[model samples]
Target chain A: MPNPTAAMLVIGDEILSGRTRDANMHHLAGRLTEHGIDLKEVRVVADDPRAIQEAVKALAGAYDHLFTSGGIGPTHDDITAENVAAAFGLPIGVRDDARAILEAHYEKQGLEINEARLRMARVPEGATLIDNPVSGAPGFTLENVHVMAGVPKIFEAMVEGLLPTLTGGQPVVSQTLRVERGEGDIAGPLGALAERYDALSFGSYPFIVNGRFGVNVVIRGQDEAEVTRAMQDLEKAFPA
Target chain B: MPNPTAAMLVIGDEILSGRTRDANMHHLAGRLTEHGIDLKEVRVVADDPRAIQEAVKALAGAYDHLFTSGGIGPTHDDITAENVAAAFGLPIGVRDDARAILEAHYEKQGLEINEARLRMARVPEGATLIDNPVSGAPGFTLENVHVMAGVPKIFEAMVEGLLPTLTGGQPVVSQTLRVERGEGDIAGPLGALAERYDALSFGSYPFIVNGRFGVNVVIRGQDEAEVTRAMQDLEKAFPA
Candidate 1:
């Protein structure tokens, strides 16, 4: 069976503005690959409601699963939950279950559950809460879209809880050979090798490190042995 | 006048597979910001031709300028120029100007201009070349879409050549205040402040640094005085 495809929507002005380097996309990509879900595309947009709503609808409709990070905190900029709810035309308000989670945690810490803090409890109707082990605020899943926090620690914890519940296909395995030659020098032979191993996908990434130009040719496939065989072929084609 | 909006299409499987963290997006964002262009959205798609074609069409139509990085190399995996040409239904092949540039560069280094090396000379019909000072392989601009290399050094060089040619509006000015308090505590007052200065944009980013919870309130606007005024309001609202 084909692997379930996933798309990630990262909503934050800070990321688009270059104020923050996104850590969630890389973290999620690695996790999804390990879990046998193919992460097809990723989008980073500003924290605008219209942009978020549009991206949510498009990605949710296109992929098997849509994972979103950021803009789920307790601030005016935290408009992702409401925008996501609006995308599906679902009514959203403070849910008792989510409220209880936040209330109990704040009470234990002797902190007041203020209005802004309570905003974290406002989840869309018919959504299931994804537990946040790092922080008390709970992320939620509405349909196939999983909403998580922007904070790396909390986002990772949410992903850990969420992945086990979803079904996945065979994990993709990859093997890479570093060819210490310009891609142009290797492209011809590499192209022929790629055609022979049609089941595996080949990616040539050029890099310039310490004034040396080289290309890292990576072969990826679900079958481990096939990936290894292709890597061997590639190694032979571009002899060290 | 409002800043010209731009979108970036990052084409690479390495980024999607979590093998490489994308440096181009952050670099482009800062440069565009400095040049008074708003980078509204960024999409990272895999090396699939269909994905690249679709994204190129969408971003090119939606934004004032579309910038693409990756896949413009001399390998079978390097299909960006062709996909981009296909997106616009334009014919593509090795252009004389581009071929001449690569031929001269390789000749100077006493290297043969082989068939794979000649692939770098492919250019979409009606596109103008963007100079690559780091490498001889020239990037091109087809309509508003600027195609550049994925390597950071080359990408930066291409951006430097391209930015001066494009018209930009007023550069966005920003001021930030760090509140060593949770976002929940500051969201209420910050929301009120954001409302008062509707022209400026307010962003509340929560962080956990050294195990201490804090939020950074950033106010951004094209008007420097307005941004400063909003920052002051944010400071007064969340007194240290």
Candidate 2:
């Protein structure tokens, strides 16, 4: 069977405005790939509520899983959690369970939970909280959408915890062979080989090293033995 | 009016599968910002024809311009040119002008243009070719969608050449200030300040430096005087 598909909705103005280079998409894509979940599409939208809700509705409805990163902070600009709830037409407020988690977490640090801090405890009705070990505020999951924080370290930690619980297909394995010749010379053979294999995906990434054009032919498949065989086949077909 | 709203469609499997971190989006976002283009959204889709066509239609229609990177190469995976033509219901074939340019480039390097190399010369009907100084293959502009190469240097070169011919609005300005306090403590005052200076967008990016939580508050606006005033107002309001 094919791998379970996933899509990501990055909710932020920072990325679109060129204020911050998005580190979460690459990290999430890598983690999902390892967990055997095929991340198919990723959309980076602004902090606008309409944009967030529209993306949430579209991506969540289209893919098996929809992951979102950013705008889950205590600040005013952080409006993802509420907008996500609105997208699903659910009631959102500070839940007792989430509040307790924040209270205990803040009590340990001898810091009182202010209104801003209390904002993080807000959860939509019928949503499961995703643990954020890096910080006190927990991310939440509503339907097929997983809403996580924008911070890199916190996002990574949340993903590490969340990925294991997801149902994934066979772990894909990939092998690459670097050909010193230009991609134009290798396209014919590579295309023929790809057609022959049919199941494995062949990606040709070109590079220029020492003023010489070359291509890195990456063969990816669920079966490791098949990937190895394909690599061997590639080497034999190219002959250096 | 809104800095000529723009969106990006990144076409590749490398980004989605997590093998390659996309440098193009960040580069494009920064360049567009400098060129006074408000990049509102960015979508990264696979090499699938349906996905590419769907994104092209959606983004191109919604935004003033849609910039695409990748899938314009000499390999079999390079299917963007033909698919883009199909999206607009336009016929695509190798044009003489593009063929002449590629032929001259390859000839200068003592290389013959093969069938695979010749594929790069294919242009959609009624499209203008975007020059690619880094390589022989040229990117093209079909209506508002600008198709560029995937390679970082080549993509950058295409963008540099393309940006000049496009219309732009006022260049956006930004100022950032680092505060050595948790976002929770700063949220209330920051929110109030944001309400006062409605024209400027304030983004609070949190970080942990030496076990202490802090936020880098970035203030951005098209008006330089307004951005500066807002920054000064922020400093005065926070007083730290």
Candidate 3:
């Protein structure tokens, strides 16, 4: 069976403004890959409601799952949850269950559940909560879209808890054979090998070692047997 | 006037598959920000022709400038050049000017300008070349889109050469005030300050230090005076 496809939507102005280097996309990409989910595309947009809603609608409709990071905190910029809810035309407000989670956590810490703090409890109707083990706030899952915090620690934790619940196909496997030759020298045989193995995908990356650049040709596919066979052929084509 | 808007398209299967971590997006974001060009959106798509072409057409049309990285090399997987041309209804082949540059580079390196190597010389019709100082292969610019190498060093060089040619608006000025309080505590006043300054943008990021998390509120705008005034107001609201 084909792998379940996914897309990521990263919403933040700080990222686009170059103040914060986005760590979530790479982290999510690695996690999703291991879980047998194919991450097809990623879109990073600024902190505008319309922009967020539009991206949510488009990505949610296109992929099997759409995971979003950032803009779910308790600040003026934390507009992702509401915008996501708006995208699906769902009514959103402070839900009793979410409020209960925040209330219990705040009570344990001897802190007041102020209005701004309570903003974290605002979830769309009919959305289930994704536990944030690192912090008190909870993320939400509405339809196939998962909304999580922007913080790396919290986002990673949410993904770990979330992936096991979803169905995924066979995890893709890859093998790389380093050729101590220029990409130009490797391209001909590699291209021919790619054509022979239509089930696999090839990627040629050039890198420098001891001041001499060489190509690392990688073979990837869902079937491990096919991947191994292709790797064997690639090694034969460019014998070290 | 507003800054010239821009978007980035990252074309690579390796990045989407998590075999490679993308450094170009963050690097491009920093460069575009410093150049006074507003980066509004960024999309990372797999190395598929339809995916590449669709993303190219959408981003290039929506933004004033579109910068693409990856898929221009001497490999079967490097299909970005032709796909981008197809998106614009332009014919593509090995143009004389691009071919001459490749030949000269190869002659200097004492390497034969073989067919695979010559693939780097393919240029779309009417597109101008963007110099790749780090490597011999040249990138190209068609309409508002600038296609460049995926390698970090080569992409950086191409961006450096390309930025000086395009017109940019006033450089965005920013100020950050760190508060040793939770984002919930900081949100009310920060949201109010954000409302007071209609032209500026506010971003509140929560960070951990010594086992305690604090909020760092960033204020950004094109006008230095307005940004400074807003910063002053923010400091007054959260006096240390």
Highest lDDT model number: 2
Q: By TM-score, how accurate is candidate 1?
A: 0.98
Q: C-alpha displacement of B214 in model 2, angstroms?
A: 0.8
Q: How good is model 2 by TM-score?
A: 0.99
Write the residue-wise lDDT of candidate 3 on B109-223 in tens digits: 8988888988999999999999977668999999999999998888988999999999988888899999998888888888988998989988899987776778888999888
Clashing pairs in 3: none
Better of 2 and 3 by DockQ: 2
Chain B TM-score, all predictions listed: 0.98, 0.98, 0.97
Show model 1 residue runs off by greater than 4 Å. Answer: none
Interface DockQ per candidate = 0.85, 0.88, 0.85
- Candidate 2 structure quality by residue, lDDT tens digits, B107-178: 998889999999999999999999999888999999999999998888999999999999998888999999
lDDT of each: 0.92, 0.93, 0.91
| Candidate 3 regions with alpha-carbon error over 4 angstroms | A209-211
Model 3 error, position B158 (Å):
0.4
Candidate 3 chain B weakest lDDT stretch, 10 residues: B207-216
* DockQ of candidate 1 against the true complex: 0.85
Docking class for model 1 is high
Chain B, candidate 2: TM?
0.98
The 10 consecutive residues of candidate 1 chain B with the worst lDDT sum are: B228-237
Candidate order, TM-score descending: 2, 1, 3
